[model samples]
Target: MEMRAKKSSRSSTSNTSGSTTTTAVERKEIERRRRQQMKSLCAKLASLIPKEHYSSKDAMTQLGSLDEAATYIKRLKERVEELRHKSASARLLAAGSGTRRGGGGGGASTSSAATTTASGGAGSSEEAGRREDDMPPAVVEVRQHNDGSSLDVVLISSAARPFKLHEVVTVLEEEGAETVNANLSVAGTKIFYTIHCKVRTYVR
Candidate 1:
């Protein structure tokens, strides 16, 4: 009976040892797999970052440290934002320049037109003096689009005499322009006229 009891105890001890060994091996395998999965995720993250943002000489070196990879990603985001801001500012500046050019062109045209009218209407030396005193200085500007599809004209003058707006419209129509819109405003002694028109490319 004593020998049987000792054999049974020995067998129990052997079984427990074998079970402990198996459990230890399984735990080790699980830990190894977890580490491999983490490494794969880090590699994927590093690949997504731009090469310019990497601080290391070799891009692969950045993947070795999680903190470095994260820093590169942050820098990439900031660079994108800075580029976006610069693009927006450039567009705004271009728009402002276009507006100013349109306004200046209109003013120049109006002034030229007024000068030509004044010169041609002066038939006699005595009449020239009277006409000059009666007619306010006029400015007219015509701006054509790059496509040659449309034009905008602006006229500004001091109301010295009865300045006819219809005469200007008639001249535009004769020049093969279809009036789209016309605006006229009188402020004190000043007259402002803005006309939007489409130019006819072919005679129809």
Candidate 2:
């Protein structure tokens, strides 16, 4: 009878230990899965921010490809308007035709020309808009993919945090730019990442 009791006690202890080990293993797996899920969420969220558009205004004007004659005509139109504004036809030359600067609609006509100082109003506002249209967008294309194969992208990201290397990789991949290599640097309060990627040709 004592032997039976000892055997039963051993079986109970063994079963309890096995169950405890199984529970520990299950808890560890659950933790790993949770971590993976959280990381995935972080990456998805990071990919939404847009990249800064950087370019020179002069470079954009060159892209317009205006013919030389058309460019000259535009210059002539602006000059005529300047002359009209100053009332500087040969008739108003005594008022000081102001040595032909030939651009920028003349500064306010001479105060001595017997005219009150002009104040810009709604007409000036519209004229300002017209002048602004001549300015180019902030960014220009430094490179573009071939016509048979190209990709474009927009992204949004959290403003509060700096991304890890892998996180940035995830974002670029999402943009369809596969990463070949990366170089990085740090400046006060900012991080700069440079990436090199091969352009893909879509044969299909």
Candidate 3:
């Protein structure tokens, strides 16, 4: 009986030792896997950062620590935001400049057209009388289709109190032209009118 009891105790001790060894091995494996995952994540982060942010020596050495990498990433984000703001501001300035240039050109063209119309056939005296009467002359351009069935008209004039659009419509109706589409815009004191019409031709 004593011998049997001793044998049983020895077996129990052996089992306990084996369990301890297995646990130790498991812990070591877990630690190794954790280290491998950390290295992989660091490599991915380093790839995202631009080379210019780091010194030439540091680029070759790679980022020394996680803290340094994080700081560099923060700086890169700030720089990108600054560049985006500058780009947006540049676009807005360009758009404003274009608008001003277009407005100036429109004013210049209106002045030139008025001068030409006044000097062309009215003579200096009649032009002076028209100016004295404060009657702003209208500029009209007409284009007819080859079939004489359609016309496109553009009218540019000053915005008088009564507005001459009604008279223009009435005249078009009397000339056997039916208005199809019209677009009107006012820039400063000048009014731009575009009209499309269909006209009937009477065959004699």
* Highest-TM-score candidate: 3
Model 2 over residues 70-174: C-alpha lDDT tens digits? 454566666754443233122212211222111123333432222443554545645755754553322111123454133222111122223345544554454
Clashes of each: 7, 6, 0
Per-candidate local distance difference test: 0.66, 0.44, 0.64
Report the Cα lDDT for candidate 1.
Answer: 0.66
- Model 2 misplacement above 4 A: 51-204
Per-residue lDDT of model 3, residues 1-204, tens digit only: 999999999999999999999999999999999988887887777777676666445553334545557778778766764554344334433433343335536646755666777555347546644663674555566666766567776776655422345556666665566889888999877778887888755689
Task: Quote the RMSD, in angstroms, for model 3.
Answer: 20.0
TM-score of each: 0.40, 0.26, 0.44
* Model 1 alpha-carbon drift over 4 Å, by segment: 44-54, 57-65, 94-204
Question: Model 1 over residues 135-197: C-alpha lDDT tens digits?
Answer: 555666666676657878777766543235566666667666788999989899887888888
Which number leads on lDDT?
1
Worst 10 residues of 2 by lDDT: 94-103
Cα-lDDT of candidate 3: 0.64
Which residue pairs in candidate 1 collide? Answer: 109-140, 109-141, 110-139, 110-140, 110-141, 111-139, 111-140
Cα shift from native, residue 173, model 3 (Å): 47
Model 3, residue 66: distance off in Å is 1.8
